[model samples]
Target chain A: MERKRASLKFLVTVMSNQAASTPAALKHTPLNATHRELSAKMVDFGGWDMPVNYGSQIEEHHVVRTGCGLFDVSHMLPLDIKGANVRAFLKRLVANNVDKLQVSGKALYSCMLNEAGGVIDDLIIYFMDESWFRLVVNAGTAEKDLAWMEKMNADWDMGLTLTPRRDLAMIAIQGPNATQALNHALPGVDSITAHLKPFNAAAMGEMFIARTGYTGEDGYEVMVLAKSAPFFWKALMEAGGKPIGLGARDTLRLEAGMNLYGQDMDETTSPLESGLAWTVDMKTERDFVGRAALEKSEITQQLVGLLLLDKGVLRGHQKVLTKHGEGEITSGTFSPTMQQSIALARIPLGIAPGEEVEVEIRDKKLKAKVVKYPFVRNGKVLI
Target chain B: MSIPADLKYTPSHEWVRVEADGTLTVGITHHAQDLLGDMVFIENPATGRSLAKGEECAVVESVKAASDVYAPVAGEVISANADVESSPEAINKDAYSAWMFKLKPANAADVAGLMDAAAYQKLVESEAH
Candidate 1:
């Protein structure tokens, strides 16, 4: 297993080297030049040239947990669906209940699934009005999601107009000091955002601000015109927001127990086994995509959190040995806030929290304990 | 970034420093630490363990991923650095000073065949492109 892991690493290195040689083929975000100006280390993330870190990824992770950090999430696609039947179209498209979003500026987290109950993507849907609803989808799956939604619109005769908002840029300001820094950056905007609850959004002309974030902290995901992203980023920095790269963003989300779209659940995995069952609405009588398959499928595996008791760091794709059967880690990392290794693993059922499991890291089988996740939130360790 | 003139380096990014006691100190190069980002965990080879040339004898894991540290030459591990195990960020601070282990070369002539600072710098530059 150790040798296999080494060979896989070598293959990845070769692929990345090839990608570096042809830089023009990679996509760049709106803040690409800004990241370069900050001397960030760039890497090819799903065909997009993204900043992994400026310097010391661990330090950047700490800054987000303790203070304020800003992230450029412009790679994610924010789509607008318009027409008279927008809400009806969404009810049949997503697995979650769209009726729950009765109030304007409310958001619902849901999984768009294939007919076989496999997740195509997990997205946040923002309801603006009966005829206008906005959705934020993953960057890597943007094109596929649009095609699927278009096909559904035509087949269902919803006659909705789906517009992919590529002309906009998104920035997430996160941490305990997030509100204070944002208020300082954009004066008087606090009056609209201060009362915004979690999973709620508010629109100020073309600019949209949502009180939602991947990191488990008080923050906002603000959207603006693509041309003004650099200026907004600079203002946020002047207001005491540190530039955080994707590396720290990853650790923070993992510590928060948030599921990364591709890493945690892909097109081959179902929401029932990916710790997203709550997001899937089965109590309603409304017919939606993938509902029939979900009802028929028997769940044999479950996603659980693993805390390494040994010294080595946990990593994805490592074998997990439980008493029931073998399992695999979906997302794993060294938690900067907890100062320990934590992982989300898809293990066999019947393994409860606090049970012991052996994770195969290289040549050694290290001891780990199953625990409820959200390992760290608001700079506090939960387990 | 800093490839000391007095030290030798391997293509895999391990740096070697010859000591007055005839033993050699082994650690990763500055360029290696810079590429790997922040170090969070390290595992060194056991003392007295014999290693072949280019053998994967140690590990240096950053927060992002884990990387294998190869033995620079055929040697036996003399001692491992306990301080680095407890606080791996020392390597990120100064890769040269925070040596991972001490090795006694099986053949002293092997150290002479290693690349000098100028050659290692050229190799790093080539890899960057």
Candidate 2:
């Protein structure tokens, strides 16, 4: 059931439902029952029966903005890196400078590469130690990610170990009072996660609490044991945390100008063009996978944020018109906080910030301005 | 779920109200808004544009996804609720009050063709099973 160089493997047991194994019928988080109890609108996201919204997505979007909302992100995959020379192996595997990981609980977001410049998956590497690092990857590409990591490990002379922790579940509580909500729900969590800054993680026995999230708000991403997931979720909800779904998640991330993995970029595209040039540390001397490919490649287009001027919503796969050339909108949404439509598009490199372009939305070419991303950060709308 | 008995409905989940001025006020039903989750952006048909019965006239994009708001009957667009365009969430707050647009019927006969509120309610119930 295990193969070399593969980072993901589903211990596929003979399930009665064949469709369940397919992406269309993916598994649900432990909180599915709780979500259904709250009358959440359920949708099939990458095969999982995930909640899109609990009644009103816009209101839930505001909850995360003004208050706190909890999301069941257990569908994401977490891989543990262990064994001798694990740090050395990762330096060759990821695009970012892993050597910069100096602290024990620091987290670094980087793109895993395929050696050909294409992105395998954008992930967060928690620098625990020299012998051990942890990676949390997207749910849809977990299988392929595991396979690639295993294959890369096989070629190395150093002893390495990779383990996917599927028995755990992840939940994120994001908002201004996110930490307080968790502290209220579970006793003693305040001291464990109180002083933790953004992009840092702390381990409290069975729970791995990371102060990181897709939403542009102060939050904690907790990875807990599967058996304890339902209890923790219920406790959070009882402690004033709204059980938010994927619907609010999409809006919150969009308002923050963060990119969705599959929608923004995939294995077929490169980080240089996917609004993630900052994640790729090319200035450092440390060579990584796909570093050579990126050095040789010509970046024809760059990802730029779009602010819709007309009365229309910008959406993905929509055609974009610019003076240099045509491009496509990678991700877009009606920002709840900004109360307007915004998007991120792959346009010609010459489309400078503050430049105006047109986006083809619903057969109408609406005007929009190109701007720097992170539209809303830390509860403030910059653009 | 407030299904106004004064207005008629289409199986596609749009509601139509016949005004004394001979124009029909159109809006998505409460059930429709509930199903769509959260209203975000709406694009009503342009004024003076003619639409056939069951025509795709307007678009209602909820945060969940985008869906077409079918014209309940054939008509010429007379007026659009521009305010809803700016604050689409109003529909979720009060679906009946937040009419998307108003239309002058090309054929008043098509108004008789739509299902009454009670009949429309039955259709909504039947869709579940």
In terms of TM-score, the best-performing candidate is 1
What is candidate 1's TM-score for chain A?
0.97
Q: Is the docking of candidate 1 incorrect, acceptable, medium or high quality?
A: acceptable
Q: Which candidate wins on lDDT?
A: 1
Predicted candidate 2 versus true structure: per-residue lDDT over A131-230, tens digit per residue? 8999999999999999988888997766688899988999999999898889999999888776898899989998899999999999999999988999
Candidate 2: where is the Cα deviation over 4 Å? A1-25, A157-159, B20-22, B117-129
Best of the candidates, DockQ: 1
lDDT of 2 at A250: 88
Among all windows of ten consecutive residues in candidate 2 chain A, which has the lowest summed lDDT? Answer: A5-14
lDDT of each: 0.91, 0.83
TM-score of chain B of 2: 0.96
